[model samples]
Target: MTPSPATAAVRVRRAELSDLDDLVALEQATFDHDLVSRAQFRRHLDSDSARVLVASANHRRFLGTALVFFRKGSRVARLYSIASLPEARGKGVGTALIEAAEAAARQRRCQSLRLEVRIDNESAIRLYERLGYRRIGPVEKGFYEDGSDAFRYAKTLA
Candidate 1:
């Protein structure tokens, strides 16, 4: 049994077609803009270079999801999106997803993982930093749907 963000054991695994609803639900519940559509989730689940990982407990309730895009002909994997239930914050859901993403990237022979977080998302920034991801590039202007800027971050895989 996997431990849930709240109390149960959490399990991280590759997403399946049945996971579309939960994936969309998490996407809608997490970000205010640039949401991942149901069609997109299906496409990602079928794509070879894209991965949608889900974290759940007892295969019942979902805890979080992470979307990773692997660049062809490149050693970089992009952590395009990652989000956990509000109650899952600071409960290792994000960390588990990140670790799974890193493993997925490494399995694909990726050398580094990269992502962009809204400049105003201090908690996310702190999480990335705490996980050893360093700021890589300049803050992107008008990055989000609400025109919020974003900070680029990256971490080299061992």
Candidate 2:
């Protein structure tokens, strides 16, 4: 049988130890360079300063994941990473994860949500802009392991 489309319906929640494998697979499949290591993901799961949100269809099959990082004595939250399966692209999986991240940031009293996307990620750029993120222009040169430039974007929370 075919899998459900993430856009049809999605469930977003905090990542648990059981979700480590799926999260790692999604990250590996979604990113080519600057990939998040499994060890880092494990650390994030147990870190209070970070929120690891996972998205799934029917609360079973994993569709995507998003990570939000918070720092003490700061009102800004950074969206460290996000990933979705190829079949989940153009669906609501990515959007749902991002919104979840924003909500998590707000819960932590963040004034804004910031992220850096690869320069070549036009699709992601469009999505971020559509979600009300303002472009902060290009970040440091060769920010990725593959020497790719990245663009910074942020959305202020009301």
Candidate 3:
């Protein structure tokens, strides 16, 4: 089934404490390795260097989440994590989240956005490539808790 027009109208916004439960559930549902704990999420939610963006439908229900990290005195920002419900995949939700992350990074005066993805995730790699991110260098060994390697990618913001 396809999403309704209303469901397709996803709003990306800064996440609040109220969305903690949904964010935790999303993390569990989306990854098998390198999971972010609730405590870590809480810390990021409160951290000045990190920004959490949530994609919501009807401004009430969260469909996806993305986290971006910025470093002081650095021009590069990291797209730390992003995930959408299986039902929301292929519906432009992930793209929306990425665009939001880039915007957030730009707002913070970042010159580029970077992210690391499992080397085996071809679909995600394609998505990143389609969005103008390119591989920065050789894949890193043991990048995840399960020892999966990852490819680092980066995009320069206009």
Candidate 4:
């Protein structure tokens, strides 16, 4: 039986090595031709400065994942990727993962959280804007594989 949203238990926590496969699968499902390989996922899992969070429902199925990197000198946190499984979209998994990342940034004394979203992803753009992120600039041809431009958004916590 499929788990219903009402009964689904969504947990957002720090991702471990064991979650790499699910993360990669979700990445592949979320983005076209921009999926991170297993090697890259392992590297991120081993990195100290990288914060990866995963959301799961019913303690079994992976719902979504978010990856963020911390910058030392500038104390800025950059959100590298935030992807949710097709079944988890619009179900608050992405928002929960993002919130967890922001909390981590706050704990690390990061001044702000910044991320780039493809200009054509209207739903994601709307979500970020609603979450208090302000677009500062555009990354010209930032997404090479698909030749899509990216819009940079930042949310200052301090």
Each model's Cα RMSD = 3.1, 4.4, 4.0, 4.5
Best by TM-score: 3
Ranking by TM-score: 3, 1, 2, 4
**Predictions in order: lDDT:** 0.88, 0.86, 0.90, 0.81
Deviating ranges (above 4 Å) for candidate 2: 1-8, 137-139
Candidate 1 Cα misplacement greater than 4 A, ranges: 1-8, 58-60
Local lDDT at 66 for model 1: 97
Instruction: Give per-residue CA lDDT, model 2, range 58-135, as digits (tens).
Output: 555678889999999999999999888888778788888888888889888999999998888899999999889998
Which stretches of candidate 4 lie above 4 Å from their native place? 1-9
Clashing pairs in 2: none
Deviation (Å) of 73 in candidate 4: 1.8
Candidate 1 lands at a TM-score of 0.91
Tens-place lDDT per residue, model 4, 1-158, is 22335324667788898897788777776778667788888988878788888888765557888999997776789998998887788877777777778888988999899998888889999989977899996565756477778889999976
When 2 and 4 are scored with lDDT, the better candidate is 2
Worst 10 residues of 2 by lDDT: 1-10
Pairs with steric clashes in candidate 4 = none
TM-score of each: 0.91, 0.90, 0.92, 0.88
> Which of the two, 1 or 2, has more TM-score?
1
Task: Select the stronger candidate by TM-score from 2 and 3.
Answer: 3
